[model samples]
Target: MTSDAPAAADKRPRKADGDRLSKLARHKHIISQLTAAPTLRASELAAVLGVSGETIRRDLMELQEQKLINRTYGGASRPFALEPALTDRKAIMIAEREAMAAVIADLILPNEVLMLGAGATTFHIARRLASRAHDITVITHDYAIAAALAVNPSIRVLCCPGRYHPNEGYVFGTQTIANINSYEANRAIVSATGISARGANDADDEAGAIYGAMAKRAAEAILVADHSKFDQRALTVFAHWTDIDRLVTDRQPEGALATALRAAGTEIIVAQL
Candidate 1:
């Protein structure tokens, strides 16, 4: 079966969605378009970018957060501030991530087998689960996640084999994907760099490949993403909305992304902060 947005290894592109550009690329395009006009409606950007109106709105929100654009009613205009690097938007939202982690930890049952992906938000989940969840076996490629879960004697931590990424502090490659595929988990809990109507995405290809493998190998897949990721697209579309059983987030997704998630039978769990 053809996946909605396959990993880079698969080399099979989803021809249906025209707005397949990464978030950073989209930001650049949006800025350029705004430069050409004083203001542009979300629908105009959506038509030009081949994405939904909701996605354009989300893009505008992200841009506004970065101080790159001024959001008007139904549209956006150029702002005076220069855009920052995409990866620079981090180290914040601690309270929100921890809240989502707490919610996920509550949902985790004893003796459950889980596949945990690497990311800041997922790391928070690991920390929360380590303190509360017992008798669960966690299989992960992230060294930090393994270390956090290892503190709980009741929980068993299994590490995957792969080349280590010094900066990201995780292991990812074909080996990691192969290792994840070797296990059958009760639930695969993964984090995303972005989540849109298309699916859960990651900025890194190797990490995304591992996430996709874990999702496919598990009985159920739970995606964890913060509000910042809402309506954002990334380099790798790891899992489609239909592949995800639940989405744990700090805020509820609105508009088109919300409708798409509902249509895909994805249950949204908003973490109370």
Candidate 2:
């Protein structure tokens, strides 16, 4: 179906995400230039990106599957709750994911305990976290996180090991839960599969078990999502809004999101993109 040559090239060029930003930078540029910014018609994105509208639609579909952005009648828009896979959304979206991750990383304290989820965004957050010299303990289901933080005895980067999930980039199972329960982290820097009006957040598989357990074990739950996870539901619900003490998302959430979370008494912390 695909060529190994291009697939192999994907890894070579993406050392630290150098070329990953190429496609996403275009997407962000278009979004920034457009007006009446609610619904982005697929045709417009295609013209801007110099691709066919169908190609843009395909991109939108990829983003929708990950719940990073919402698809409307004609196009997609940034929703308040989403965990998109920029890796699959073309190289450009990976840049956007990394940008989003940088914003999410602000929630980390110098020496706080962090719980990271598995995905494109959290992977970038892991990279940023690696540079900081904090007595930090990163609890994660992501195999990447452990490997990234390995050899760094200064920051206790612990992985919640289980059945490895290739897609979400983590391992999940009872062992993951057990490791998560063992840690009493001060804060959890995590992501979700999706969100809904009723305040249910879900993820793929029972993989959310580690996410839920970490949130419950932590003193604070700092949900790091872009403005895309809103109004969607995944296979499993990690927790509800009441448990989400502080939410760190890109840009100030508006529209129904402002109404929805306020009604639930959840504190919204927006990062300037």
Candidate 3:
């Protein structure tokens, strides 16, 4: 009787926990989890949220209808995506970003010029270079990246001239593109909001334009992104796989993306955690 009572108590709905959360709050959590992982099973989500399996299924159904997630066999996956604000993104995947940054920084040689695009992962690379790289020039449209690279006295940082995007903390427009075109770089290190068989992509067209310009102007284009970006399709494909020289990421891309990279002859460098 005592054992049965304890088991019953354990099975009771956590009314003080997940039950108190609103549907909107649960949806937000579901999205957050999906962002950090490749896929989520319905059973795991039910256990974590302390909700009934049916409730979780209903939530997944609604999110799928809204195109927020891709429903899988008893699971969910990241959709062809949209990203949050830059500030919000900066807070996510810190360790993965830092690991990728380290690998990218090591690939850079002294006295080389690099074109950096605007994104949270690239920002982490900028910070890594500031501490480790030497005698390098970094040209970027992101004011924050320029400031980060400036901390290294040996690195020369140039900010592009263009209209400032208040929310993104970067410059973008005709001037930015022209300026990027004028400088030939040893390498371009950029981040994408998504990477699918279609190639590297961004959620914002203006940001995509900047990344595209950088890739064209540089001798080698290196894309630094973490695993969560895998299979995500975004608003614009900035650089085709053939245009990219190397990909620095925390995980090896599988499925169609791996096939595309192999076909395009782009090198994949998986950073050690």
Candidate 4:
């Protein structure tokens, strides 16, 4: 207050420091990652943190623990449970996920038996199929996917039996695996919870495990995921690059992933959006 002394201004706490909800709001943001796919590049995420890459990784671990979202290579995303949170995720990625699925369906041939996995993207693809073709047997563990084909008598639809996750709109469990194993699919179109540099498809929970089981029984494995899934590892890995027949995505997957998948002998098809 003296002329010789520098006057100190009153200090207020940052909103992040003052509001308990500031913490909860942080939790809410990870759900945004689910919607921000294809555009959420890992390198860009590391840049946003203002910390070293390693620090951001540790931060992601804490988010993963809250079950707000699963950890990805450079980010975090909403968990698979059906909830208002998932609905939020769905709204953001609608155009991109739809584009990726459109690219995947372009390769389908008539009279092929296909196993569709659970995820909003898969549900979108099934809807497209319902309009375009008939006499194709679609096998799936997802109620939403099965229902999309319900009125189509020409397309034979098989539903797997197991525990149904109402949030994910899919059936998954040992019973689901048993049902999936009973039939052989010509090609299996599935989605992933995340993709790792190791070129593996990872899932957030046990539902992922059942999808992996059915994928192995198919003659060809075609993964239908958008660019957002790249550079992340989930709770369980369903298949490796060596196991995948093709990767159908909205954009070309980048980073260590493109090389790893190619080296593993997997063909990547970038869907034209």
Question: Which candidate achieves the best TM-score against the true structure?
Answer: 3
Candidate 1's C-alpha runs over 4 A off are 1-90
Question: For model 2, what is the error of residue 62's alpha carbon versus the real structure, in angstroms, after optimal superposition?
Answer: 20
Q: In candidate 4, which residue pairs clash?
A: 38-228, 82-167
Model 4 quality (TM-score) = 0.70
CA RMSD of all predictions: 14.6, 15.1, 8.2, 9.4
Residue pairs with backbone overlap in model 1: none
What tens-digit string does per-residue lDDT give for candidate 4 at 1-273? 459877785342225455423434433443455544423444544454333566556556776786756666555554643223446656777888878767767777889898888777788888888877768998888887899977677889988888878777777788888888899999888887677655555545576687677679899988877777777666677788888888888778775788788788888887666
How do these models rank on TM-score, best leading? 3, 1, 4, 2
Could you tell me the lDDT of residue 272 within candidate 2?
53
What TM-score number comes out for model 2? 0.63
Model 2 Cα shift for residue 10 (angstroms): 54
Report the lDDT of model 4 for residue 139.
Answer: 88
Candidate 1 lDDT trough over 10 residues, lowest sum: 80-89
Greater lDDT among 2 and 4 belongs to 4
| Sliding window of 10 residues with minimal summed lDDT for model 3 | 6-15
Highest lDDT among the candidates is held by which one?
Answer: 3
TM-score for all models, in order of appearance: 0.71, 0.63, 0.75, 0.70
lDDT of 1: 0.84
Flag regions of model 2 displaced more than 4 Å: 1-86, 89-96, 151-153
